[model samples]
Target: MAYVINDDCIACGSCLDECPTEAIAEGDIYTIDADACTDCGTCADVCPTDAIHPA
Candidate 1:
């Protein structure tokens, strides 16, 4: 499974650097590219707003 960035994201960029697979990208609210996500859940760990979730 891949992780998705929810609309609650505040673009704090915590998850972007936390992703080991570099699947998360910066955007208006940040986005996770499922193709590259390894489902390691690293990004979700550091998300202060808890916007990253399983997809």
Candidate 2:
């Protein structure tokens, strides 16, 4: 499974740099590219809003 960014995302850009595979994309709520996500959970670790979870 891949990590998904939920509506709780604040677009703080915290997860973007943390993703080892560069799966995250900037947007109103931010999005994780499931195809590129490596399921490393690094993004979730740094998310201030705890918006990232397994999908």
Candidate 3:
């Protein structure tokens, strides 16, 4: 399964650079493109708010 960004996201932009596939998109809450996500968990590790998780 792909990783998902939840409402807990603080829009910190921390996950963007950490995403190897560049699946993350900028927004008020930010979002992850499921099609591009590889479930690497890299983005989730860098999320300061612990917002990203398994889908």
lDDT of each: 0.89, 0.93, 0.92
Task: Please write out the lDDT profile of model 3 over residues 1-55, one tens digit for every residue.
Answer: 9999999999989998999899999999999899999999999888888899999
lDDT of 1: 0.89
TM-score for each candidate, following the candidate numbering = 0.92, 0.96, 0.96
Better of 1 and 2 by lDDT: 2
Candidates 1 and 3 compared: the better one by TM-score is 3
* Global fold similarity of model 2 (TM-score): 0.96
Off by over 4 Å in 1: none
**Residue by residue across 1-55, what tens digits does model 2's lDDT show?**
9899999999999888888888999999999898999899999999999999999
lDDT of 1 by residue, 1-55 (tens): 9999999999998887778888888889999999999999988889899888999
**Models ranked on lDDT:** 2, 3, 1
* CA deviation > 4 Å runs, candidate 2: none
Q: Who wins the TM-score comparison?
A: 2
